[model samples]
Target: MPGSSILVTTDKESVARRMESLHVFRLKLLSEEMCWLILSQKAFTGRSQASREILEDIGRKIANKRQGLPLAAKTSGVLLQDKQGREEWQNVLNNVIWK
Candidate 1:
């Protein structure tokens, strides 16, 4: 097995420790801007410029509540994908999970 390599990714420290001599690199959390970018890309693909401007502030708030987690932002984006109203986005920002 000369010049052969295998790459494995895991979030659990226990799993990572089971293998010796493995190179480990930790991933950094997303920034607020990055989270907003992901959410906007997922939820507002065809939204109008005016609509985007109207919702941008609330969207940033929602993105901030994601706590720099990409998965959280992606999930929120999916939840808002079909919603276009400011109230709908505001409702998400007001959700108890962010409390």
Candidate 2:
């Protein structure tokens, strides 16, 4: 395992210390500003403007509910991908049970 590499992420500093992670990256919450950005890159990938057009105002509200989690934002984006209309987006926002 000399050349093998492992990376772990956590929100707790105590857990990080316990792991004795050689390198720690303390990341700030993904800003609402960047939530869309992450969604664009991770979820939408190729459909940028289309996403913006469909998402619009409601998208920001939905993205905010993710609470700065990149995975949540990306998941939202993927869930919205290929769907049309604000009602579709609104359904996603209103349904927050997280399955």
lDDT (C-alpha, whole model) for all candidates: 0.86, 0.77
lDDT score, candidate 1, position 93: 93
Candidate 1 regions off by >4 Å?
A: 1-24
Kindly list the per-residue Cα lDDT of model 2 for residues 1-99, writing each as its tens digit.
799977877889888889888888888899997897776555455666876677678878878888888888888888877667778878887995853
Clashing pairs in 2: none
- Displacement of residue 38 (Cα, Å) in model 1 is 0.5
The C-alpha RMSD of each candidate to the native structure, in angstroms, is: 3.4, 3.1
Residue 19 Cα positional deviation in candidate 2, in Å, after optimal superposition: 3.4
